[model samples]
Every structure is written in C-alpha cells, then in structure tokens.
Target: MLFSTIVATSRAVGTTRSRRTKVEELRSLLAVLEPVEVEPAVSWLAGEPRQGRIGVGWRTLAGARVDPADAPSLTVSDVDRAFTELAGLAGTGSTGRRRELLATLLGAATTAEQEFLVRLLTGDLRQGALEGVMTDAVAATAGLPAETVRRAFMLSGQLSVTAAAALTGGADALTAFRLEVGRPIRPMLASPAPSLADAYSRFGGDVSVEYKLDGARIQVHRHDETVRVFTRTLREITGSVPELVDLVAALPCTSVVLDGETLALDPAGRPRPFQETMSRFGAESAHDLLLHPYFFDCLHLDGVDLLDAPLAERLDALQRVAPEHRIPGVLQPDDAAAKAQFEAALAAGHEGVVVKDLTAPYAAGRRGRAWQKVKPEHTLDLVVLGAEWGYGRRTGYLSNLHLGARDPDGGEPIMVGKTFKGLTDALLQWQTEEFPRHERSRDAHAVYLRPELVVEIELDGVQVSPRYPGGVALRFARVVRYRPDKTAAEADTIDAVRALLPATDSG
Candidate 1:
C-alpha cells in the first residue's frame, strides 16, 4: 500500500469523533496494507524524532530529512532502520544534524503523509485515538472482538505484537496469554468520573480511595537485588533515582513488580513542589536530591504473576512485600467516609484522590470506570498579558492567552504561563475583538495585549520552572471565566503567588 493511503485513513480516523467511524476507517486501511508495509505504517504514525538546542538564545529544534526520490524505495525495513538510527542519535551530536535528518525524512513524503508524520513525531496527534483506537481497528480488521485485542495489548506492550497475534493466532490466542517480566505492559489509567458521589455509586460498595499525589507515575521492576524504574512513557530512569532502586532492592520478596508515584517530600512529610521532584530526576547528582517512592499496586510477586489478580489482592501483596514507609494504604470505605477522606486528603495538601473498585483487575493502558480520580474544582485569578492567533477550529480568534501575576512591590506583571484551554467559540470571538483594543503591538501570529484584563484561571497545580519569569508555572492551567469585576492592578501579586506555593523543604 502507498504511504498516501495510510495517511488518508489516518486523516479520516482523526477527523471523526465517533469510535465506530475510526474503527471502520482503520479496518478498511488495514485490509489493504500488506504485512510488509505494516511496520513502516506504524513507525510513521508513532515514532518520536531527536530534538535539542544549539545555544541558550536559540529555539529548541527537531530533526528530519526527506528526499523525494527516497519515498518510492521506502520499506518497513527502511523505516525500522531509520528509527533505530534516530534513537541512537538522541543523546549525541549537535541538535542541528538531528533536525536536518528528521526534516529530510518527513520532507520526502507527500503533503497528507507529511501531516500524519509531523503529528506522530511531535506526539500531539489529538485524535482521541491512540493505542486504544488502534486496538479497535485491529480487531475490526481481523474479525475479532475488541476485548480480544485489548487483552493482547495488555499482555504485550507493543501494538505490532498485538497486530501480529491477531493476524496469525486469532482471538483465542490472546485470551490464553500471560504477561512476562523484563517486558513492559502499558500502565492502566483512571477514567474521568462525573463526581465523587457518582463514582462511588457506580462501584456500588467495596472500593478503595487513594491520595492522588501531584507527582510522576512510575513502574518499578525488581529481580532479586536489582531494580529498574520506568516512567509512564516507558523511558528508563533507574540511574536518575538510585535511592529508589535501593528502596526497591530492599523489598522482602525475591522478585516483584510494583506501581506507584514518586514524589519529593519535605522533612515535615508534606509533598514538595513538583518541579523539585522532576528536577531531582534530571539533576547531575540525583542522589543529592531527596526523593521518595510510594508503592500502591503490585503486578508481580515472588515468581507469581498478579496482573490477573483483583485490586484488593494486589494491594495486599504490595503491602506484604514492600516496606511500611514505602507502601501507603489505599483509602477504602463507604460513600460518606470516602468523601470525608477525600476532603481530608485535599486539606492535607494532596491533589485529590483516586477511587478504585476492589474486584477490578489491572486494565493495562485502558482508562475505565474501574478506577477514577476525584480532584477539587480548580480556580485562580490571573492578569492577561498577551494573546496569540488561533489555528484549525480556533482560526480568526485570539485562542492562546498569556497570563501573569502581579509583581511584588508593584512593578511589571510577571508572565507565569500561557493557555488556550477553556475557551468557548463565543468567548474566543469576544477576546479576539476586545484584545486588540488593549493591544500594545501586533506580530505575525500574536497580538501583545496591555495589562488590562483580569481573568479567573484554574489549574491542576503549580510546578517549579526555569522557563517562566516567576520561576514557577501552572500545570494544566485554563481559564475558568473572565473576572471583569477586577482591574489589572487588583490581580493577585507575587507575594500572594508565593503564599499559594506548596510548602517545600527550603522553607
């Protein structure tokens, strides 16, 4: 099959919000894709390219090389060779070479193929269809049930592995499989629930709620005395957190697979700023940075596989094998008690809580009602500093808005973040018209607005950053609504910002 055909199908899949439509499009494309072309198609749709910067003042860059003549000769083996070569270049050489290589490869493709390739390389293919959608597509193409494909993916971390299984062994083979160690499985995630009460109602009874810390998710695999840790994206970081490896090595079990969040905490036992924890992992002397791992689930224990086990059983095994300091108990209770516990967790400075059904098995890579996160409604007061032109559906509107907090001692506002989230089409139109009235200047793609609008913003949490002028940036920040009642001078200040900062070890 031609690359353009795959690109066309991907475009059709992305444009339609309906899962059925996506599945159908993928199935039609898969039917014509020769086995020899499958790997290349997958690589072009999922691979990440090398990136970096030349100097402090230079913009970060991506690498790709495309020769039009090479497009006809492209094969699955060639794609595999390119990805292997690109991965090898990730940590070496000037950033320019990598960017050039990537540009060359992508430039070789036709326009539609280039669009698909760009989205895949940038990791921002907002089609709401990733591995899950692919699973459905594979199942539809192979004449198997979606559940069968899902199970195969759960056991084998690779989508290609699942595809091969569906194409050869058929659906029955998927159901008979078990997961192996040393090989990673996609991590299960919580689905959004309407409300805490609603989540509790759905679970009926016998559920566990755990504090959802504002930290990075990790999977720790231990064999005898050796342990390895990986992030949600499956990047190895065992060397970055040597202390965590030591902690896992000390577990009583001979071999175990544990899942949890790793957060940096203060001597007072409160969670430290998220930036501190993230910085700890990337620091030159990671050991110098105090970090802690809180184990919450056990997927393997003492030569036995626990992936097929229920959550309650896994939690029990996790507590038995892991040390007390490292294993925090899940919050299990009745409806009223769970809500009270959630409120208590929030009051104690936790992000929120994740409620899990006791009997549900780990649904790797799947977001389902088996687990749900309950975070408090987010809101903040921010001053608008600028606006950027919108794209796609947001075209002709001031979609991206720059936000800042007041400077201490009354100086220029310090820009902390920018966001395009939480804007209705009507709101976008209003901002596009009103922002120019306060415009300080206009650029090719953005309008610099005067410090005039004060809006109520909301976010998950504040993270430490070197990028923002305030030395801090908001995580998942979005506009709650326009706070027209407040003037720019009345917007929140740096001292107020400092007050909102989570208590840290430095204090």
Candidate 2:
C-alpha cells in the first residue's frame, strides 16, 4: 500500500473523538496492509518507529530545514529501511550523516507526510490512540478475541509482531506466543488499595499479604545455563549487572522464570534509599552493595509454565526453586492478621504491603483487584506541566509546580493540580538550573514544560473541581521526589486519581 493511505487514515483517526470511529478507521487501514507491511504501519500509527528512537532527537529534527515534496510516493518499506540505517549510525561524525539522510527522507515527503514523520520521530503523535487501542483494532479486524491478542502481546512482548501474527494466522497463531524460559513477559501488575483494612475486607478468605518492597522490579528468566534479567519495561540489562547474573544462574532449577525485586540493605538491615540502589547500575559501590532478590511469583519453573496457575500454586513453585529468596509473606484470612502484617511491613522499613487474591492466576499486564497495594501514605507519580516563579527567600527560582495525570486513552496528560510544598532548598536550586532545559514556553509568572518530567506527588486526597480538565483537583499535593527512572508515559492516570474521590451515601 502507498504510504499516503496510512497517513490519511492516521489523520482521520486523530480528527475524531469517538473511540469506535478510531477503531473502525484503524481496522480498515490494517485490512489493506500487506502481511510484510503490517509491522511498520502499526508502529508508525502508534507514534514510534519500528527501528526505535532512530538516533534522531528534538534538537536534530528542529535543526533540519528540508522542504516537502510536491506529491506522496514513499512506501512504508522505504521509510522503515531509512530508519534502519539512521538507527545504525554511531561514532563521532555520525550526526552529519544522520542529518543528511533524515533531510533527504523528509525532502521526499509531502506536507502531511512530513508532519507525520516529524510526529513519529519526536514521540508526539497526539493521535489520542496508542498501542492499547491499536491492539483492539487489530483484534477487531482479525475477528479474534481481544483477550487472545492481549495475551499474545503480554507473552510475546512485542505488539507489532503479535498484530502481524493475528492478522496473518488469526487466533491459533497467538497460542504459539506462550511463556518461554528465557524470554521476559510483561510483569503482572497490581491495583491500588484505598487502605489495608479495605483490601483485607475485599478478599478475606483467599489472600496473601506480602511485603511491598521499595526496590527495582526484576524479571529473571533462566534456560539451561543462561540467565537474563529484564526491567519492568522488558529492557535487558544483563551486561550492566554482573552480580545479578551470578545470583540468578545459581538457582537450583534448570529452566525457570522468577518475578521479584532486587535491593540493597543498609548496615542496620533497613532497605537503602531507592537512589542508592539505583546507583549500583554502573558504580562499584561503597561497602559492596549486595543485591538481594526477593521472589514473589514464578511464571515458569523447571518444565512447567505457571502463568495460568493460581497464585498459591505459583508461590509453591517459587518456594521449591528459590526457597531462600522467597519474599516475606503470610497467607492470611482474617482482617486482624492482614492488618498486623501490613503494619509489620511498614515497621520493617518497607513500602507497605501487597494483599493478593490467592486463587487468581497470574494476570500479566492487568492491574485489577486480584492484587492490591497499600502504602503508608497516598503518593502518586504525576507529570510536571509547568513551574511558577518563587518570591522572597525563594526569589527567581521556580517553586510552584503544575502537575498532570496520564490520560486513560493514551492522550496527553490531563491537568489535575499544582503545588510548591515539600521541596527543599536543594530541590529549588536544582529546579532553577534544570527547568529552563525543558521549557516549552514561558511567561512572567510561570514557565511551561514539555510534560516529560515525572514527579512523585504525595497528597491528602482529591476533590470535585470545575477548574481542571480532569474534573478533580489534588488536595494538598506536594512533591515527594523526582522519578528520574520513570517516564511521563508511566505516570499515574486520571482514572486512578478519580478513584480517590470522597465516598457517596449510596456506597
């Protein structure tokens, strides 16, 4: 198919507010794409290049001044091949070569196609739809179940390949995308619990209350002698952490996949600060920071796949394989015991507790009520949209913050609230020095940002509001910390914020 067909469909999809319309348009586009063209087409539509990043940044794109071609004739393969070369460029003089190629590619595109290229390259498609919606579209087009496609995606860890598989071979093809011994699947997620008591009441009989550790999530997969560790986003960091490889490879089982957290403890046996643990990434640490793995669930063990097994069964397998590394937990049925465990987790210098439904199978990528996490206080990761200037002792520094929540529909973050509290003098100094680097626009009072920085904001609660676009304002929001490890895409969503609303009489 011609590249213009995809571009026009994308424009049509972005112009509408109805999700049904978006899915219909995307499905029609997917229906026409050749089997080989499917991956690139879907990847572009989802605001990412199939080649990933492609060595181009906002600076390089902004510096290029290529004119548009009069007509549209570039094929999808043409763009994908160009990106393959662009992404392969490295070394000192790579910038000139990449820019030359990028300009030549952009010079061949019409105005609309050029706009699409810019959006795709800059990670700002603003199409109001993303991989999640496109997954639905692909499923609708293939006449397959949505869950089938989602399951395939979660296991395969590649939506582009999964979509193509469903399109070319239908639901039967998805069955092949199962838990492999070495491949990392998307980790199972949990929903936020209002409180420990509420979560205990929800699943009283079949629940395991476990310590919610303040550490990095690691999915260790082993096959024969090979062991690979993947982050939450499935990026492999095997070469970066030598100690982890040794620790995971020493497990008793031949083929296993364990989901767990890795952290370093201080001298007093308390969990070290998150940054200190993160500092172990490349540095030879002080006092030889040992990464302790705390296994909570096992997806695959020995020769059996436990992804479909209940949590109780999974935990049993985890205990058998890595009994020494099993996370601290207790199978509790009474509210009093669960509450006591929650308090114990906090007292141990952990985050809080995760109360999991013991009978629920491992629901990868689903943050349903099967697993609920409760912290000591309410904290949310929100995007910083802008910052207002300070006065008096904080003069000339950016003090007040404008915060936003990720939209449920994968659109831009919605403005929910703002705050200047909880920032130390050092934070204020850092903001003054760093805020200008991310400035998108500026006024006398505040400087608007690109919504790229995610800040952990602790708030009392939320209230009904007429001002914010989300129809709710965060009450007493304050910055707890800056999450450099996370991106704006991972920020807590507006739907999550709305769930904090004060209860009604009907409930």
Candidate 3:
C-alpha cells in the first residue's frame, strides 16, 4: 500500500479525541495495507527508524525506488531489516539528513495522513489512546479479545510483536506464551488517588503501604552472576550503576527479577537531593557514589515467573531472596499515621512514601490502582519575568511564563524556571491583557514582562542545574495561584532557598 493511504487514516485518527474513531480509522488503514506495509506505517507513526525491539526500517530512497511489481512480501522480518538500515544511516549522517529523509518518506503521504504521521513521529500524539488503545486496535483487527493482546504484550514486551502474533497465531498463541530473559518487559506504573482515605477505602484494611522514595525506578534481572539493570522505559544502564550490579549479583537467588528504586544516600542514610542524585547518575567519573537499592517487588525467583502472583506473595519472595538492607517497608494505613510518616520522612530528609495494594499483581505497563504515591508539595514565591505565545488550543494566549527568584543580597531576581501549567482560560486572558502593561521589551515570539508580579509556584522538588541563572531548577513546577498580597521584593531569597536543599553527608 502507498504511504499516502496510511497517512490519511492516521490524520483521521489524530483529528478526533474519540478512541473508537481512532481505532476505526487505524483498522480501515490496516485492511488495505499488505503485512509488509505495516512496518513503514508504524515507523512513520513512531517517528524513529524501527529499532531492535520494533520491526526494521528501510531506506526511504531504496524503499521508494522499488518497483511496485517487484515489491517483496511484507513480513515482520522485512520491517526489522528496514529499521536496521535506517538505524545505521541515523548513526552516521547529519541530523538534518535524517530529518530530511524522514520528511521525504512522509511527504509521499497525503496532508491529513502527514499530520498524523508527524504527530506519531514526534511522540506528540495526544489522542489519550496509547498502548491500551493500541491493544484494543490489534484485538479488533485480529478478531481476538483485548486481554489476549494485553497478555501477549506483557510477555513479549513489544506491541508490534503482540500485534503480529495475534494476526498470525491467534489468541491461543498468546495465552501459552512465556517470558524470556535479556528481553525487557514493560514496567508497571501506579495511578493517582485524590487522597489516602480514598485509596484505603478501595483496598480495605489489609493493603500494604511502602515508603515511596524519590529516586529512579529500576528493574534488575539476574541470571546467576550476570546482572542487567533497566530503567522504567526498558533502556539498559547496567554499566552506569556498577554498585547496583554488585548488590544484585550478591543476592542469594541464582536467577531473579526484582523491581525497586535506586537512590543516592547521604552518610546520615537520608536520601540525597534529587539534583545531586541525577548529577551523580550522569557523571563520567569512575569514582563510585553511595547508592541504595530499595527492593519493593519481586517478579522472578530462581527460574519461576512471579508476574501472575499476588503483591503479598511477591513481597514475601522479595524478602526471602533480597538482602535485608535493600528491602523497603514502612507501614502507614490511616491519614494521621500516613501524615506522621510523611513528616518523619521529610524531617529525615527523604521524599514521601508510596502506598500500595498488597493483592494486585504486577500489571506491567499498565497504570492502574495497584500503587499510589504521595509527596509533599513544594511551593515558592516567584516573580514573572516574561511570557511567550501559546499554540494549538492555547493559541492567542500567554501560555509560557518565565519565573525568577530573589537574590539574597538584593539585586536583580535570578531566572529559575519556566512553566505553562496551572492556567485557566480566564487567567490566560487576564495575563494577555495585563502583561503588556508591564512590558519591558518584545521579541518576535515573546514579551518581556517587568519582574513585578509575585506568584505562588508549586513543584515536586528543586534540582541543582547549570542551565538556570539561579543554579537550580524546579521539578514538575506548576502554578498554585497568584500571590497578590506579596511583592517581588518580599519573595524568598537564595539563602532561604539553599536551606531547603537536602542535607549532604560530608563522609
């Protein structure tokens, strides 16, 4: 099938917020596509040349040059080959050439198709139907149930693999599948709850609540002495975390798969500031820094897969095989108890705790009610320095706002961060109208506002950074509300800001 056909269906899918419409459009497109065309179509959608896990990609020039009469039968292997060639080209050539190549391939598509193709390629497809929706699509197209496709995905760790399996082997193939090592399965994620009470009411009294440390989520797979560590996204980083390898290799079990968080800890045993941990993780220095691996869940022990096991069972296995120091458990069931634990955690310089359900299995890649996290809100009084134009639904509004913090010695406020979050339509309109009144200068895209307005900004935590003028950046920062009563001069100072830094162990 022509790229244009795929593009058109993708565009139709992108234009609507409805999952049913998107699935229908994708199915219609899939009907006309030869199995061979699936790779290019998906490649064009995902934006990357197919990589190791996904099918292979082909050179656009070579692929487009193929005569329609001689076009080979499209198979999963062909897709894999194409992606391998694309990956090689991407590694050696200029970024512009790669982008140009991608654009040329996409240009072979229709305008509507081009829109969806671009959205997919750029990872900006916001239809709210991600993997789950894709699973539904695969199931619908293959005459299988969504659960069959989901199970296949859980085992194989690749959507396209599951899709192909369902299309070729049917539902029975999926149900009988088993997991293999060296292949990464998707990590499970937790959904949010409004409050602790709501979470408790759902799970009842027997649910487990574990301390949710602020750290990077990791999955460690060990077979005898060999160990591999992967991030939540399944990207391997075994070499970067040598200490973790030592710790995992030392575990009692001969073969195991464990889920946990890796945190940099100070001498006091408190978690280091997130910025410090990130910097340490990114450092090129061979010198080792102290890291704590807090094992919370076990998926595989010995040669047995525990993915189907209950959380309580997994916890028991985790305790049995993993080291005592690595296991993380602190029970807090009630609001008062949870709040007290939260305070103690903060006082001890640790991030808040994660409350989990003891009965839920590891729902790989699915963000369900299995786990819930609670962290103390970090709010700051910051001055608005400038505003930038918004896009799409937010077009014509002052959406991006530059924020700054007061200098300790009292001079110009240092630029700390920028945020487009927490704005209502009314607030946007007010800012658009009122900001120009305080305009100091103008660029082609943005208006520089006077550092006069002080707004209360909330964030997850502060990270030290070389990019910001303040030498720090806020993580997950958003607006709480405007602080109309506080002037910019009355904003918090650098010294006051430094005090909020996590305590560092000199040892």
| Top of the candidates by TM-score | 2
lDDT digits (tens) for residues 1-507 of candidate 1: 555666676666655545577667767777777775664554344332222111211122232434445344344455445555655564557466557656655666665555555555443332222455677778888889888788887777667667766765687767666766556677887754546887787888678888878777788888877788887656678888889888888878788888888888888888887667777656555766678888778999989998888999998887788757443334568777888878877877777888889999998876567987777864556888888999998888888989988653233577888999989888898998898767667889999876668787877767677898778887788887775434554566554445445668115
Model 2 TM-score is 0.93
Cα distance off (Å), candidate 3, residue 491:
30
lDDT at residue 106 of model 1 (Cα atoms): 62
Instruction: Give TM per candidate.
Output: 0.68, 0.93, 0.67
lDDT of 2 by residue, 1-507 (tens): 878888998888766656788788989999989999999888888678878877787789877758899998899889888999999999998999988888888988999999888777876663322566788899999999898998999898878899999999998899988788778887787777789888878876689999999888889988988988888768777776678788888888799999989889888889998877767654543336777789899998888998888999999898888888889999955777887888889999999999899989987865678999999888888989999999999898999999999865556678999999999999999998998877777999999886678899989999899899888999999888887766676678888898888787113
Q: Which regions of candidate 3 fall more than 4 Å away from where they truly are?
A: 52-83, 90-129, 280-287, 331-340, 378-443, 446-507
Worst 10 residues of 2 by lDDT: 123-132
Candidate 2 at residue 348, lDDT?
A: 93
The per-residue C-alpha lDDT of model 1 at residue 254 equals: 86
Best by lDDT: 2
Q: What is the alpha-carbon lDDT for the whole of candidate 3?
A: 0.66
Candidate RMSDs in order: 12.9, 2.5, 13.7
Q: State residue 160's C-alpha deviation in candidate 1, in Å.
A: 2.8
